[model samples]
Target: MTSAPPTTEPWAAPHARGPVQAAVSLPGSKSLTNRALVLAALAEGPSVVRRALRSRDTLLMAGALTALGARVETATDDWTVEPAPLVGGGSVDCGLAGTVTRFVPPVAGLADGPVAFDGDPGMRTRPVGEVLTALRALGVRIDGDRLPFTVHGTGSLRGGRVVLDASGSSQFVSALLLAGARFEEGLDLLHDGKALPSQPHIDMTVAMLRGHGVEVDDGEPARWRVAPGPILAVDQSIEPDLSNAAAFLALAATTGGRVTVRDWPAQTTQAGDAIRDLLGRMGCSVLRDELGLTVTGSDRIKGIDVDLHEVGELTPVVAALCALADGPSYLRGIAHIRGHETDRIAALATELRGLGADVTELADGLELRPATLHGGLFRSYADHRMAHAAAVLGSAVEGVRVDDVAATSKTFPDFPAVWSALLDAR
Candidate 1:
């Protein structure tokens, strides 16, 4: 987390006096960048991840890999990961990153000694027990069930059949599959709980595994078979982070402005890509061309009734948009988000209500009714998505302030600058 220190000073959220016209180029996808780094570290040869996101979460991942004996050169936009003999006796700081907490343990299980893992004070509540318990069932010696645990490896793991509940997060599924190819007997993972969240994230994991020359059989529902073999190294270029572009695009959707996000991929498995359809349903004009993707707001922002179980990360910003709508909205099927960086549903309800919106926090989602919005202090809860949500409402609601705008650097390093630039757009 090389971002600026968290401050007590509240940042006044910029308001759009009129329609905004802006075009901005976003950074690389953190999801893709972290996954690429892990795979490259486990590959048979050196791998290059071009245009990787140099944010807090991704940097934590790179650091974890380095702690486990991989040489990760992140000095440039392109990061080169050199695979070395897996050793242990290292400690990894998870740093409030769900990816780091979930993804690194499997890799740590292949090291020669004991590797310790811990994260931010807030990450204590997040779930890593599912992954840790599953790794134990797959023949890895683990000291604890959650963060602040240690993986005692004998330089290998006996991975085979393991079934556990992954309903809480898709990262658990991805964590196992990423290192399954290196397991001695390979891996057969099954989900024996409720429905999984973020199916696209799991799909993304599968695609990346295949791209790295690892064989994965996900032909059956809720079941994946990974065949043990050498992971092939491949040079790769990352797609722009559409998720980070959400708050920026929200500026247009709220103010009848026009915003273009540069280098939007024509096809993607990114969950953030769903924002186009989401915004469109809210009466925003969406167009995709060689210039990239553009979203223009309508005279009125309409409330939507939609299920966000597959795209829970977008909940905060979507909830903010719902707060700005003239009508009511029902966002459901995302109860799993209770386990995110913060309890997002509760945080949204508290913050929105504080900002003078009619908000009802439900067990699975939220119910937002139209109300006149006013500005108060909007706190970010040390969660980047929370900060993005604050900015969304603040754009229309006057006198909005964010407690810690630097929290945006978790994935979007240039967020403050980009936001100022967006407001300056005419």
Candidate 2:
């Protein structure tokens, strides 16, 4: 995959001239779309994924599956996935997506040939060894324990009882679980790690597996049992990306305006679903109605003490809101975010500090103390969420230009145009 867009010039983030009002219709959930792609590609028959995200990450996932012999047709309408006898002897470009690198290897193990996986230079540094090592212990022949590794697919995996620490990422657990039922012996996986982050994501995986007719017994914490069975083909409908919506919702919160995200689900395992309660705690009036989920900003944004362990992906945007809050805020239980696209805690602290907020980077999270802010250039470090943090702050703090705004294309390729339309609707 191509490296993130060049960063020779900074994009001038639109500063809100007044209280903005608009309805923002976001795209499908990257989380759901990627997961659906994997499950559908391993199902007994052809399956459909409605409203699947067409961004870099989801496309990379489709490409990876296709490389492993699955027939995935990406259309202007919807994506159709047809399962094929997985035979490898192909290469996978994971780009900078954690989902692709973390989720594809186990599936590759079930293929018949060798599959090599690699990605951007920075992705090489991301944490992927745990899952890779686990695969090795499960009788898959793997060349390395990280990105830039090769999985020698043997047309089958003897998947049963493997234990590992999943503290670094929930993706490791979800990855193993997604492909577990396909293993000849199925899988009895156990996590012998510290508290798992993003439990909801694992729940989403389990729920989706069951929806596809696979038996997943996650009754006990940190342990999962997948029975060997055929995954039934079903058309899956993905919800709007609530994590991406957090950026827009933050725009409303900081500018004391109103913003609505269309088609917010009543229930979901997406970690982004935590935005409703979290935004509400931060002094935004969150309402779910026929129109969808709406956030009406109060006169003053409130600081909050929240533990985002299960919803760590929302940290960047939430931290941006905290930087503009009316009081000190402590965001805890998300140290795992540091291993994300960038060192998220450090990135947030530095950028918010550059914008004149009193920020402290903790070993596990961040502590933001409200302060007067001014405009300046914010570096995205080629991270989509970091670019998002800058945009949220720029809406209120004038002249906050963001470098490599194109990094948002990792998920939302139309972020700039859609954001501009939302503001211009005022």
Candidate 3:
């Protein structure tokens, strides 16, 4: 584990004012980067992935692929992968990336050796039973349904209908879909309840698979079918992360500054697009241009009552913004936040309470009142979103001390730097 430098200087609060202007570029999406890395590693020929996210999560995925016998090289915004038969018989440290821990194991099942998947303490607590059950149904030898688990692949997988209780993370379904081509009959997925959260992520998964020549048929809410086919090598560029864009948007809104993020695609399957509509409701002037998105700060942020089902990942950022709004904000449709890097709703509520905000955590979501924020020491719970949320709060309040600041490396390793740049631009 690399030691992150200490943030000895306390974050100073931004004075509430009017239109600040800046241009910012966020790291590529960890979701897209890891998925592309896995696909590239499984391809028949050498492939180049451009603008890959260089965060800890994506790096862990890349390391896992390399350990499984893929030769990967990186050169300034590009990654070249040379596929070789997976050596199989090795233990893979997935770090704290749930995506890598859950998604890579199924793919590793196609290798010739026993692959043991493990991660940080938090990753071990996250449930992988749904994926394990599905893999077991397909004849993979899985010792347990939890992390620190071992899988021995048989070089070929038998695919069939698998009933998955994805809970909220779409990576489980995505993992199976991405590796479906290597199966004899492909994969069929069945949902047990109201389907998983972040459904758009699943759509993104299907879209990426189709781009590589694999076909998946959507048969309704719970049923999905994938046809066996060979994945052709193709050069692909990942879209700029909409999730990371939220923090800057919030910064603009809170400080009454105008911030623009470059290279953001207008039409994206990501759930973070809900930020645009949500920001509009908060009285921010939002403009979508050919190059990217511009959000101008409002005189006063307004509270909103809405369900953030699709854009659940942005819940923490939005909720933090709500703490500075004019009235009480109620956010619903995020019961799954409890299962993320931390019990986000509870953690956010607790932290906000420490900052003197009238925040309450419900069974499904949270209700926060607009109040004067005071700075204090903030704990991140080692969750990346928590760290970012704390930073946003710090921007709005003085003397905010954030512990575990380095936790941002999980997604945006350069978060502190990017945040500093945004501040400097102001």
Candidate 4:
């Protein structure tokens, strides 16, 4: 929320003239950083999150926690979180961050006053009603069903069994589970509707909760149980954001170059980890070695038909890659992305068509047919992922200008610099 003022002019994206060879070290995962911050805020004692991502979204999360009574000390990428009594009567700027909007309310419910939550004008459309309504069902006094809402915390939430459809977003489930152990009677959460998107994120919530000594039973599908207990504080190291890596990797895939992202974990619950498989299917040579994970592009990029429901965040970059492919692609199982930072499906479809590609919008996804692309002004729509996608396309197509490049700060604040460095290394 403290980002610098945006430029009035569009940024002319740097084109990759040849094979790009570089080792890119990305910042920590925004998802993990925010989740760790929330858990540390509610833990039994102070905790440390090492190499945390210091981007706009994560900073907004830190600010929100501070407003809720947690003492967070930061130096570089390390954060020392000191737990304090959760109070109320404050305001939180959700700032177009899904994590901030969806995850903070449960923590706010344990506070002592009215914690008003609002976000950017765009956040008004993102789904938050399910989480708020679920809080009410669990005997918490909450006003309003979406962003620009308020949670009247009475120092405790009378948590018990609650069933709601989490088909729109998995954050609703993770949000409740993050603070469920602190509830008076704990929480029993069940999803009664369609399958959830981003299942790995919910898994991550459960894993982190267990690491903090909270007993969470997710053995059954669509059901999560958190037993009332004390949350233990622990020092932690976060993995690199694989989602952001997808954009850089896509550069290699599009230009027949080689890009390696350092510190790619051997195993992860991050939904972004699917990028390895996704890029591999697009005819990129993927390998993991002592030098980290390297992707080498093929002479020709092939189109792919894949379901990206679980890794919907990667859709923009994938869609950009698809636009440059040799054939048609069908990206499905990501209708939920429509409710993201912006209507990503519509945005991607519109932008790609503007660049002379044949893109058809589907209810659940997009079908992209390869066409000769010409330079055009690509707008970022104030979505960080959209900015990344624009940059990826820019590397391949000359004269590709992106408006509001500063929007990349939502997660990777140094995206433009990092991208330039990668291309310069060639």
Candidate 5:
């Protein structure tokens, strides 16, 4: 097992005033990168992936593919994957990446060997039973309900109608879709009564599948039918992550400064675009150019009530921005956050309170009042999002210290360096 990275303390002095200009080549989307890795591993021949994210999440996915018999090599910014027949199956450690932990197992079900999937403590707690149950229905062998779980691949998986409960995370549904091509008859997926929280993420999954030459029939009420076929390999570039874009967007709101993010795609299915509308309602001047986006902070931000069901992952960042607003902000429709890398709702509330914000954790979401934030040491709880959220909030307050800054490696490995660049540009 690889050792976790060293922890660091992240502290930020309040920005006095300035316009921030930066041309950043943001890392590739971890979500897309992982999905592509899985699909490429399942493809027939060699596939070239350009500008693949090298962050911890994608690294775990790549390593898992290597464990599954795919030969992976890196050359400069591109990763070349030569798919091999699944010969030897062994244990795959997913580290702290929930995407890799949940999504990898289902793809492994199509292999010929018994693959044991496990992860870091955080990934172990995330629910994989939904995918496991679906795989079992498709004639795959699954052992137990928790990590260190084993999947005995049957070489061929049969397609069946499955009603998925995806409220917790969309990765389960995406995983099934990626592996659908190998199934004998393919799959027809139906969503349970619970509403799909992050529809855009699901859309992104489908889009990437299509790019990989897999055909999916997207129907109404969240029904999808994937045909069993070979996935055609192609050279593809991953788009900028909207989730990563949120932190910099919040920077503008926190400092009353102007910051621009370059190389951001104009069109994206990522749910994090909710930040634009959400921030606009919060009284920030957000402008998008052909190159990227520019957000100018307002002198006084006004809070608004909103539901973040589709963009639940952005809840913490939104809550942090709301703390600097003029009035109380109400955010709902994110009850599933409790099951993420950490109990995000409770963790955010605790850390925000530590920064002197009046925050209440509701069953589904949170209510935050605009209060002066005092910089103090904040805990990351070993969660990357928690660490990034605390660091972004710390930029708005004096003397803010974020413990375990290294946790950001899970998604953006160069978070501290990126934040430093943004600060320097200001």
Candidate 6:
């Protein structure tokens, strides 16, 4: 992915002058919101999604579903989705949302017309061929394997047993499962490749489907069977995004302060909840109470060695934490992240190295050693999580500006305002 143009001014990330102590509340989970929208679009009745995240990614999901004939009312924080007949002859703009690019097409196959799909330039590089190939095998007509392709629909899909490698992304599995209930034979899908990445996301899909009265058998590893039936439209309450809390909690961890994230769920299917364990392992004190989950930073940020295969989304912020530690850290089992919004592993290595950290870029993850980090412009490569890492670094190492802090708009509507509010800055 390309960085913002040279002419674009960078956002000067707020530097923490002292221990950062604040109770922060984040927006709804983008993952859940998008998935909820998709389920609502295919459900048997109208659905309400409460406290939905109104961001670029989620808005794109709503727009894509609307384009394919789902009426999504998004004027307020709560979105109402009304399912209708899937019509053909529509064009969809996936933006940069992997969910929109990957998840929408499978449902579009149930339409009776042709749906053209395209997205942001970066999305063209993301791994989406698995969805298209799987759809083709399930008796759907797809014109191309990549972005700028078209799904020619004839009103129904012959869904049955299909095997493909889902090692690149878990969304491929979820895309089909989200729309599988309406299929004639349903979907019996199996992963025939390396270890599947983001298994929690697939689990989230299965759980939600079951909640919506869709029968899913996930007792077998990397195998999911969806039975043919109608999807019930259910009201969904989106939990406060635990993943976005990473940066705020990192503020406490990096500055030896205490930060509490309000409404942190006691139980969640979100893989981001893994951040609690990660921060605790890195020398932070974690506690849960009625107020929320609180993180108190340790005076010494200890380095860690761990695999992040299930929680790859935590890599960026976690990498920044590793850079500021007193010892070396190695993060592994997240090679699949290279296909995310950007080449996250490469972007993190480049930006961290530029900011004066000892970094080694491996095929799977990163190895970071303690170094005297200084101020520099950390390019985000148009990826939201990359900007998160930069903001976390700026809390300790001064002068760490982020190029294209707006990239966070993909998840949080106004991350700068949120981050600045932690410092009591407008």
lDDT of model 1 at residue 125? 78
Q: Which consecutive 10 residues in model 1 have the weakest lDDT in total? A: 1-10
Better candidate by lDDT, 1 or 5:
1
lDDT, model 4, position 317: 95
- Model 2 C-alpha lDDT per residue in residues 1-426, reported as the tens digit of each score: 123455558888888888889887889999999999999999999989998988999999999999999999997648999999998889999999999999999999999989999998879888999998899999888998677899999999988999989999999999999999999899999999799999999999999999999999998889999999898999988899889999998877988899988888887788897899988998889999888999999888899999999999999999999989989999999989888988888888888899899998899999988799999988887899999999998888889998889999989999988887766666
User: CA lDDT of each candidate?
Assistant: 0.92, 0.90, 0.81, 0.91, 0.80, 0.92
Which wins on lDDT, candidate 3 or candidate 6? Answer: 6
Encode model 4's per-residue lDDT on 1-426: one tens digit a residue: 122235558888899889988788999999999999999999999999999999999999999999999999876678999999999989999998999999999899899999999998888888899999998888778878887999999898889999989999999899999999999899999999987999999999999999999999999989999999899999999999989899988888878999999989988889999999988999999998876789999888889999998999999999999999999999999999998888889989998899998999999999999899999988888888988999999999999998889898999889888887777777
Clashing pairs in 4: none
Task: Please report, as a residue range, the 10-residue window in candidate 2 with the lowest summed lDDT.
Answer: 1-10
lDDT of prediction 6: 0.92
Overlapping backbone residue pairs in candidate 1 total 0
TM-score per model over all chains: 0.98, 0.98, 0.95, 0.98, 0.95, 0.98
User: Which residue segments of model 5 deviate by more than 4 Å?
Assistant: 1-6, 9-23
Clashing pairs in 5: none
- What is the C-alpha lDDT profile of model 3 across 1-426, one tens digit per residue? 122344444434343333457888888888788888888888878888899888888888888999889988875688888888887888899887888887888788888888888888777776678888889988899887777899998777888778878766777788888888877888888877654788888888888888888888985775778888787787888888888789878888878888888887878877777788899999898899986898888789999999887668898899888998998999998988777777788888888899989898898899988788888877777788877788787777777777777888888988887786667667
Candidate 4 has a TM-score of: 0.98
Model 5: lDDT to the true structure: 0.80
lDDT of 6 by residue, 1-426 (tens): 466453358999888888888998899999999999999999999989999999999999998998989999999998999999999899999988999998999998999999999998888888899999999988888998899999999999889998888999999999999999999999999999999999999989999999999999989887899999999989999999988988888888888999999999888999999999999999999998889999999789999999999999999999999999999999999999999998899999999999999999999999999899999999998899999999999988889998788889999978998898887631
- Once model 2 is optimally superposed onto the true structure by TM-score, how far is the C-alpha of residue 417 displaced, in angstroms? 0.9
